[model samples]
Target: MQAQPEKKHSSTCDSKEDSNKLESRYQFCGNALRITRDFSNNLGISAIIWESGLVLCRYFEQEKISFSGKKVIELGSGTGIVGILAILLGGDVTLTDQPVVLNQIEFNVTSNIPVSIIQRSKVSDLRWGKNEDQFPTDYDFILGSDIVYSPHDFPSLIKTLQHLSNQNTIIYISSKMRETMGAIDFHEKLLPQHFNSELVHRNEEKEINVYKVTKKAREQPSA
Candidate 1:
């Protein structure tokens, strides 16, 4: 939840040539990523990179988490930073978000990741409640950053998670805890029934937390 300093600039690119945008650089594990975002655009909140995303990336990088040959899908992947890092770590990743933000996700994936590693990644359009058929259900890891804020979207988000995961799938989420309490409520609602949730890391000063979620085991029938 460390506050990010803003960097503004004008850029010409494939998606929207001749537009003003905000650009930022994040570095982790000797790798650096340059991301461009359009906060003033009609894409709304999906255009900005949040502190929780940065904290999650930092934690994974510092811990040397291995994603080698793993299948990973990132939900609400604004700027696609976490998914990009997964690709760098040898994961086959799909970076997904609402359709409007897919262009930005694609741009970041192509511009920042080298051709050698870039082949391991793809960008897909995904809305939380809908499009369940569009994605594969057997992902090894599911990632999300700063996505648990909206109370209205909670049910859809949870349903989407259930649709994507198998019994062995591991879900990672990073969220900023603010006055709204929406993120906290999301965790409380997803308890022993659906997933076993754990608070893996926290930045108390910034009010950010990283959670590791695993699907709960099914009950065995008595003979």
Candidate 2:
């Protein structure tokens, strides 16, 4: 006889060890979200949840942004907290990160989000500057949180953002305003030519800034 397959179970959290690693509970719009992060630093920065992610999520809830039927993509989705919140706001979301972090993204999405919302969301492996064709370019909203920490990756990060955005796309980036490696440098490199940058929200307590990036309007030529 063939061996029976192992049974699968679903719960509000992952295993005990995983919860012990890094667990966060959030209450948004009367709904609760629990995100678990379980990975070593060797896997990459995606193993931890940053202050920018938390600030962004709070801003979204406070503003009550309606994402109904919107297509959104999150780049460098660590712990997938922001992507999960996007799904809660009714956006069809794709959470993308490096291959090593995809499993953690899926785990958080499955454990925290409801089945209906999870059905409209997915996890994908996307490396900046490479395999650009693999990701969709027609997203209405592009999201990134704490993705600009390294100046070395700035070029690739900008390239990825440009590849994913079009005339009608809006990109929201939440970054901690650190003296070193903050997003101001990245914004300086993005203005006038690529997109119009607006500082939408700032929280001094958390030291996070939320920026809204929109495509620049084309200039009309003289006859």
Highest lDDT, which number? 1
**Runs with alpha carbons beyond 4 Å of true place in candidate 2:** 1-20, 218-223
Q: Which lDDT value does model 1 have at 45?
A: 82
**Tens digits of per-residue lDDT for model 1 on 74-139?**
999988988988888889999999888988888889888888777799998889888966787899
The prediction achieving the highest TM-score against the true structure is 1
Model 2 per-residue lDDT tens digits across residues 1-223: 2212212212133334553366767776555788878766455577777878877777777767877899999999989989988998889999999888888888889998887567889999889999767777799999999987888887788788888888899898988866587456676664435788877887766677788888776789989
Judge candidate 2 at residue 144 and give its lDDT.
92
TM-score of each: 0.87, 0.85
Query: Candidate 1, overall lDDT?
Result: 0.81
lDDT of the candidates, in the order given? 0.81, 0.79
How many residue pairs in model 1 have overlapping backbones? 0
Backbone collision tally, model 2: 0
| Model 1 misplaced stretches (Cα beyond 4 Å) | 1-19, 179-181
